[model samples]
Target chain A: MEHEKTQIERHTSKQFDVELEDVREQVLTMGGLVEQQIANGVKALIDGDSALGEDVARSDYKINTMEVAIDEACTKILARRQPQAGDLRLVLAIAKTITDLERIGDEAEKIGRMAVHLAGKDRPPSAFRQISQLGGHVRQMVRDSLDAFARMDTEAALAVAQHDAEVDREYEGVMRQCITFMMEDPRTIKHMLDVMWSVKALERIGDHATNISEYVVYLVGGRDVRHLSIEELEKEAARAISPRTGQ
Target chain B: MEHEKTQIERHTSKQFDVELEDVREQVLTMGGLVEQQIANGVKALIDGDSALGEDVARSDYKINTMEVAIDEACTKILARRQPQAGDLRLVLAIAKTITDLERIGDEAEKIGRMAVHLAGKDRPPSAFRQISQLGGHVRQMVRDSLDAFARMDTEAALAVAQHDAEVDREYEGVMRQCITFMMEDPRTIKHMLDVMWSVKALERIGDHATNISEYVVYLVGGRDVRHLSIEELEKEAARAISPRTGQ
Candidate 1:
């Protein structure tokens, strides 16, 4: 009777592991959709493709749907499996990650809407170079943050968090340049305002990515690193990975 | 023996109820702190009080600490008690609600920083009237949303969500006015930019409040009302509250 119960317990544990993996995979799939939305949103703005812009904006519902589905799955896991310690943190992290991902999708949709608004406007001589650069940086950050979460790599997560500062600086540069353009010619105020909004959305996307990376660290490192500096986060991540070095 | 087992089970269940209640109370306390931060942050900007701005910015850490503490307590409860059904939903909603509250605190801190920047600069002739109005509107929304959560009142939550549209309109008006001010006088561009940032932060605060209200709806209604129109959300919330009325 003891041997039979052990076999049953082992099978249940294996099934729980598969369920957890399924949730993680779904989160990554959602992350990929968000990344694509950001890219298409930016592309639509830069290329003045209103059709693409509208498409990207309309497609945000997909990300929203995924978020709700994933969250429900996590809730079910918590209720049924009663995940403990590391498993509990993993489930919680995925729940939080999807929220950030959904917000990132919202930001991308905002950018898409801005793109449609700016489609007929006069393009500055700079051709939105700074905004384009900032968009690229943040898109990469989002991708890296997801990859970190997928691999449960603390170092990669820290790297993604550290890149946030650079993204912020790039965002500042874009804002300053837009202000300069508006001040130089009052006729460009409306156009520049749309550009400013788009850039701001991109910058916020970067923040959402950083939040995701923080969740990755929390999930793996078992420490809440929400408000910590990158340096402090690095220390904590290192300690989480190496027990003997930890204090 | 069965009677003794029932008594022990009852004691444990009671303890779990107290734990859940403690977390909920802590979340409300944190909400109160965040509401104060928004109020103070806006006041600091409107009054040009650099000291107050600095204080508000510095005090954000208190909210951050509370968020971490509350989240940890929720995780502990989930692991130990494995709360089912309604209790599980309560714990999850608190987790999500605190995130929005923390972000609201972050927005308030941004407003504080902008206030410090604008304090040393010229105040607009219009005296930031639009921003102050927007600030007042969002502050009330925050208060109302927290009240809705405390009472689990679906009607109140729906009301708060509906108010978000008005807040968005107010935000757009402020943006338009700021742009006009900058366009009329290039000299006011820098000052107007600072005012714009403060108003943007206020607008984001409104979004956060809407998020919290959505969480309240989800907690009480047991339905994901996110991405739903106010009308649809009202229908869903009503159905969740009264099954006979549900379609």
Candidate 2:
């Protein structure tokens, strides 16, 4: 009877491990696709290519499908495995993280839609410059946040959160400039709103990346770092990574 | 051995039922608080009452706390109970629903913050009139969605999803008016942006409400209604609520 019980336990453990890895791989693949969508959307905006924008918009269906698939997989695993402790935290965090990724995809689609509207509209070169700069910064943040999650690097995740503040400041600057241009020329009002909304979408993507980083922190240390100031997060991260730090 | 198995089954089922009820009650309570926050936030905007706006902003912490608590409870239930079939779907839907509720609260807080910024600003009476009309409509949608959720009324849920399109139209109308006003008077640009964002936030609230309604459909019928058109959703709802209608 003891030998039979041991065999059953081993079988279940192996199956659970395989299921967890499969879900994680799919999540990373979804993340990569979302990142590409963002890039393609912004490139369409800068290049004034509505066709490219349409392609990006069309590709979002894949991201949405992936989100639903991952969520369903997570639910099935929870019902079947009932994993506990750190494993459980990882599963829950992954489930939550996918929601943010899906939202990021949605925002990217919004950007793509805006790009389509801005196609062939006369805009100052400086607007494109600002969009490119802001887009690059947020895209790097997204990549780093996902990498942090993959590597379980709490410090890198914390850095992504800190980077979000800079993105916010840049977004405000872009908005001010766009408003100024609109005020100077009434003809530019519609196009400027498009630029303004695109920048807002990019800034929100930065926030979602920050959220993903916070989830990484939670998954690694079982501590939710959301709604915390950078200073507070830094202190918490220090303790989370090394409980005896400064002691 | 058969008698022992039956006794254990009864004990576990009773415990699961109690836990599920407790979580459901808490979720409804949280939903109620969020609804109040939206009303107060919109009132502050319409009244130009910065004091009321500040109150809404401060009250958001309570909503955030409730979200965290409800989420924790759901996670615990998922891990320990390992509920299957309909029970599992209910728990997962509740978990997903709370995230949307929390975001709705955040949107309210954003409106409150914008209201404070717009206090004493010089704006046309038409802007306030438009805001009042739009805010009232979306607020009703929020209330009806919650009521539908509490009753598990699929028809009401489907109706809320249909109503979101109207909110979107009103939002675009408001945006056009705000932009026209800003273009006519450069001095009003900053203030108009605040009003513009407030309306945008309200529209987003309507979307969240729609999402909650979809969750209700999912919870009751074990169907995922996300990413579906309103027409598609209506058909699914019809089939879900009346499984043997065609038969």
Candidate 3:
């Protein structure tokens, strides 16, 4: 009887592991969808493709649906499996990660909306070159953050978090250029405001990605790195992964 | 022996209720702090009180600490008690609600930061009248959302959610006025941009408040009201609370 019970317990534990893995995979899938949204949203804006922008905006519902589905799965896991310690943290991190992902998706949709709004206006001479560059940088950050999450790599997470500062600087540069354009021609103010909104969305996307990286660190390093400096995060990550810690 | 077992189970369940109540109360306390932060942040900007703005920015750490502590407590409760059904949803909603509250606090900090940046600039004759009005509107939304959460009043939550549209309109008005100011005299571009940032932050705080009210609807109504229109949300809330449903 004892042997039989142990076998049953082992099988249940294995099933729980599978459930956790399934949730993590779903989160990655959702991240991929959001990344595509950001890319298409930015492309639509820079290329003045109203059809693509509308498509991108319409597709945001998919991300929102995934977020709700994934959150339900996590809640079910917590209720049924009663995850403890590391497992509990993993579930919690994924829950928080999806919220950020959903918000990133929202920002991308805002970019798409801005693109549609700007499509009717005359394109400026710079043609949003700076926005294109910043968009690429923010997109890379989102991808890298998801990569860190997929691998549960604390070092990679820290790197992505640190890269947000560069994204901020790029965002500021875009804003300055928009202001200059608006000043040069008062007629451009309305159009430039649309561009400003798009870049602001991209900048916010970078922040959401940084938030996801912080969750990765929290999951892998067992530390809440939300408000910490990059240097502080690095030290915490090192301590978490050190040989003496036996993590 | 059966009677004794029942008594012990009852005691455990009562303790669980106390734990849940404690977390809820803590969330309300945190909400109160965030509300104060928004008031002070906006007041600082409107009055050009650098000291007050600096204090609001500095005090954001308290909200962060509360968020971390509340999240940890929720995790512990989930691990130890494994609350089921309604209890589980309550815990999950609180978790999500606190995330929004923390973000609202972050927006208030941004407003405070912008205030500090603008204190050195020449105040425009209009003196941010639109921003002050929008600030008051958003602060009320935050308060009403928290009140709804505290009472689990779906009608109140829906009202707060609907009020966000007015906040958005106000935000747009401020943005348009800022553009006019910058266009009239390019020299004011820098200061106007600072004012614009503050208004943007206020707009986002309204969004965060809407998110919180949505959570209240989810928790009380047993439905994910996110991405739903106010009309649909009202229908869901009514159905969830209907006597025929026997909730």
Q: Can you write out model 3's per-residue Cα lDDT over B22-123, one digit (the tens) per residue?
A: 999999999999999999999899888889999999999999999999998998898899899889999999999899999999999999998888877777
Summarize candidate 1's per-residue lDDT along A128-199 as a digit string, tens digits.
Answer: 877788889999999999999999988899999899999999888878888888778878887887888898
RMSD of each: 2.0, 1.9, 1.9
Provide the global lDDT of candidate 1 against the true structure: 0.91
- Model 2 DockQ, alpha carbons vs. true complex: 0.63
**TM-score winner between candidates 1 and 3:** 1
Better of 2 and 3 by DockQ: 3
Order of models, best TM-score first: 1, 2, 3
DockQ: which candidate is best? 1
lDDT over C-alpha atoms for residue B138 of model 1: 99
CA lDDT, every prediction? 0.91, 0.88, 0.90
Task: Give candidate 2 misplaced runs (Cα > 4 Å).
Answer: A243-247, B244-247
TM-score of each model, paired residue for residue: 0.97, 0.96, 0.96
Instruction: List residue ranges in candidate 3 displaced over 4 A.
Output: A124-127, A244-247, B124-127, B244-247
Candidate 2 residues A1-247, lDDT tens each? Answer: 9999999999999999999999999999999999999999999999989999999988898998998899889888988898987888888888888999999999999999998999989878887898899999999999999999998888999999999999999888889889889878877887888888899999999999998999888777777667778998898777678954456
Model 3 alpha-carbon miss at residue A22, Å: 1.7
